[model samples]
Target: MLATTIYEQGDHRWIMFGRDPDKAEGIIDTNQYLVISGEEAILLDPGGIELFAPMLSAVLKYVPADQIRYLFASHQDPDIISSLGLWDQALPNASLYSPWLWEGFIRHFGMERIRYCAIPDEGLNLTVGRIQLQFVPAHYLHSSGNFHVYDPKAKILMSGDVGAALEPGEPPLWVENMSQHSAHMKTFHQRWMPSNEAKDHWLRRVRQLDIDIMAPQHGRLFKQAHVDEFFNWFEQLSVGIALR
Candidate 1:
């Protein structure tokens, strides 16, 4: 797994870990984000069970295991937070912030130690040390109960599966070209995302924020102008293809 600092400004930093070349075959690659704000830190969508060892090893390279004070899952997907059991043992006192709808379901992954902080449907604001983060509602774009994290200070949005793509091998960390990248993301969004109404609602809300980087759980991240290009493309595409 490769760990890269996507954003940094003194004690406030956003480190993305993914693109693991040694990952087992047939398992989808996923990105895990770590946010550090002074003495506090949060791990977002910590990947599946197969990734726990490498993910933990990669994360410990920056912040100590104990300093990971928080965990945030966009929804209750196995790929999204199946490592909960392992993380529970690692960050015993850390709290997990996830949608209220999935508290009971997510707990099945094993929550003997970590406390669950359910995020309401309306979303909520959380402060980690010196930085303020927003849990933005993202229901039905893919999952029925989902939320994305937005950091206003870094102008970064951890969009979960909203911008995910399924590629065969390791790809570039950031989307270098929007037109070419659209092909990679098209099928995943059309099939996985089950609602056009939900997509519109999410687009409307996300457009209101000033975002510089759009970080998704799978595939490449979008930066600057590519971020706007993504909105323009996604806003017009019709999702829920399986129903048709």
Candidate 2:
């Protein structure tokens, strides 16, 4: 997988690893994020078992394995963090930050070597070198215990599955048109994100933040105008409406 630098300023950098032409068939495409702040770095949703090798190699290009002091799992999905065992062996001393509710279940992936930092239902602040990252609650958007990483300094929200879009092939890294992009997102949100209440709650919380980019684990990132457009669209769409 190719690791592309999506955002960088001073000692802070956000690298997205994806758009792999050699990705195995039947395996869903995923986007892994690496956030660097000085010497310390964090890997967000490091990906499934099949992606460990390439993902690690891509990460090592930017920072040494030891520099990756933290691993953030947005939820316990296989695509989200099934590589925990491999990551445990690679970064032996790093800590894994995830929702407290899934600690027991996710531990099955691997937690023997690395420490597991259980985030409360309300979420918490995680400091990596000079950057303070916020773990914002996104409960039941898809997972019963989901959370999103928000970087106040960068105004970027690593939104877990909140804004994910599934495309048949490689798509552009960012949304160029909101109307066109809505097609890629609508069905996924209506089907996978089972609760309108949770969706509305998350939208209200997100609107209060000053976000420049809304990055999801699955598809293209939303930036600037598209960010607001997504919020407006998500707010009105009735999630779980198909069930009735």
Candidate 3:
């Protein structure tokens, strides 16, 4: 079984483990996230069928599968939502919350079992007791339907692949070694964006958000000043700075 580490900043918590440490060429290490609200929880990106056991095992550390009330995906990439069917089978009562943009694709997995909600034009806010969630438009960062999630209360952003790294075998998923992680981040930016214009657009827009903890799909979680530096580095990378 793949091992995972639990990372938390107050009420905001995430459990990340392994899939592809090196990230391969076009391959990526699938990441799963959970955003807790009151007694209810919203999960993000359920990943593959093979990952179900490990993912479920990791999530149970914090809350029971039956306790999960919602599941959300940034988009409907196979790696992001395949295991959702498993979650539906495992936790029958939990509702799936996804970007309505890709509901058809997601429904293919859950079949009739998948109930969905569209991403709002003005974005959405989910409250689970005291915790609050805000959806940010990723626009062109990855895919048209893709979006990122932010927690204003915790200052944590669950950025899906926007700040990813091929950090295979990296321990502690926290910007523990920024220099090395920066190298991977640079390479990711190069291949992840479609055009310089889109890259520039994402950089400028993301800067307006108040971010403290950057919980990317891969690599480490960046907190505080490092979060600022990451945006600066991303701006440079978007303009063609060589990271490695």
Candidate 4:
């Protein structure tokens, strides 16, 4: 199904679209994000080849395809990068923004299509008119060459699949129940994060941030209350203090 929703929170607007939330197993029904700034327009995690047309169509409502300045991928997953080739062709002038480690991975797909601007371990900064972006590092959340994005201005953390929630059809954009979302979050972390040490490190690193929104790829956009409550539970689960 084609589920799309547009939200305007304060100064920024978000256009979100993807497959039904509940079908998220080993599947890549992840939602793609479109971050528009005064000077630039960017598409985040534009994967899932099927969603490209709608993603662009949704984007066309705001700006021209050529106006896109950047494509940001939190990691190198097929659902995240598969359609990048199409984007590369569409936005010939736009450049890809990703973690440096993903440099080879993006090239592995085919380098001539787009220009890659690899970010560092700590993160990189991007400017869209006056808005600045800080790419926060969440090493090995689901992959070694992974990272998270923090938009201080928007108080958003586009945290890949680390804090995801899957519900069959049309899952709510932001989960309201910390307990319910907590279960799905736990299963994902435990199965994907096999190294306890790395998990702990990523947890502590994340805790250092002052977040108001935890926008994961799969679930509801956890707002302030749920952010604090969910993190508290996630911290416990990460430390192995809880079980299935």
Candidate 5:
């Protein structure tokens, strides 16, 4: 697993972990993020069971296990938070932030120690130390109750699956060309993201924010210019076309 610091300023930092060359052959590549503010930290989409050991090892290098005060799951997908059981044991007092709709279902993974912080459908603001994080509603972009985290300080929007791309092997961390990257993202969005109305709604909401980086769970990150380009392209995309 590769751990790269994508953003850092003052006491806040964002680290992205992905592109594990040793990852299992059949497992889809996934990116996990860690956000740190002062002494508190949060893990985003901690990943599946197979990745738990490496993920934890990678995370401990920057922040101690006890400093992980929270875990954010964009949705209830196994790839998103299946490491809940291990995390439960590792950070006994940390809280899990996720959509209220999937609390019961996600708990099946494990919840013996960590408390669940259920986010409302309209989303909410959470504070870690001095930094305030916004949980923005992104419902039906793919999941029934999905949310993306927006950090005003870092100007980063942790977009979950909204901008995900499918690619073989390890790819560069950030998108350099909009036209070339579109090919990687197009089919995934068309097939996985089911509703055009929802897609439009999410895009409009995201456009209102001052985003410097658009970080997805499965593909290259989009920075500055690429962020706007992706938003423009996705806004015009025709999703839910697979059935036709």
Candidate 6:
């Protein structure tokens, strides 16, 4: 697994971990994010159970396990939070912030030690160290109940699967060119994303924010002009083709 610091300023920083070369074949690749502000840190979409060992090992290089006070899951997908049980053991006192609608379902992954702070459908705000993170509602873009993290201070949006891709093998961490990268993302979005109405709402909400970087839970990061390019492309693409 590779760990890269996507952003940093003072004690506030963002680290992205992914591109596991030794990962077992047949499993889809995933990206996990860590946001640290002073003493507290939050892990986002920490990946599946199979990725637990390497993900934990990579995270330890930056912050101690105990310092990870919070865990955020965009939805109840297995690849997104199946490692909940292992994480409960690792961060015994940490709390998980996830969709309230899936509390019952997510608990099946195991939640004896860690507290579950269900995020209401309207979403909510959380403060860690010096930064305030907003859990923005993003329902039906793929899942019945989902949310994405937005950091006003950093001008970054941890956009879950909104801009995800299914690129094969190892790819660069950042998207230097959208023309080449959009193809990898196109099919994934049209198939997995199920609601055009949901997509449009999310686009409007995000456009209001001054985003500098849009980081998804899979593939490369979108920055600067590429971020705008993503918005333009996604706004026009007609998703939920399976239903058609």
Off by over 4 Å in 1: none
Task: Give the Å shift of residue 74 in candidate 5.
Answer: 0.4
Candidate 2 global CA lDDT score: 0.92
Spell out the clash pairs found in candidate 3. 21-168, 37-128, 38-128, 100-118, 100-119, 173-220
Report each candidate's C-alpha RMSD, comma-separated, in the order given. 0.8, 0.9, 3.9, 3.4, 0.7, 0.8
List candidate 4 stretches off by more than 4 Å. Answer: 1-11, 20-27, 238-244
Error of 4 at 122 (Å): 1.9
Give one digit per residue, the lDDT tens place, for model 3 in 1-244: 3344344656555555555443345655666777665567778776766677777877787787766877778877787888877887888877676776778778888645545767864468866546777777776567667778887776778888777877655346568666677887776778765556766776676777788778777666787778878777776775333433
Q: How does candidate 4 fare on TM-score?
A: 0.87
Worst 10 residues of 6 by lDDT: 168-177
**Local lDDT at 71 for model 2:** 97
Report the C-alpha lDDT of model 5 over 6-44, residue by residue, as the tens digit.
999988999999987778888999999999999999999
State TM-scores per candidate. Answer: 0.98, 0.98, 0.83, 0.87, 0.99, 0.98
Model 6 over residues 1-244: C-alpha lDDT tens digits? 8889989999999999998888888888999999999999999999999999999999999998888999999999999999999998999999999999999999999999999999999999999989999999999868999999999999999999999989886788889888899899999999999999999999998999999999999889998778989999999999999978
Cα deviation of 32 in candidate 2 (Å)?
A: 0.6
Clashing pairs for predicted structure model 2, backbone only: none
Candidate 1 C-alpha lDDT tens digits along 8-127: 999999999998878988889899999999989999999999999999999998999888999999999999999999999999999999999999999999999999999999999999
What is the lDDT of every predicted structure here?
0.94, 0.92, 0.70, 0.72, 0.94, 0.94
Off by over 4 Å in 6: none
Rate residue 41 of model 4 by lDDT: 74
lDDT of 3 at 49: 66
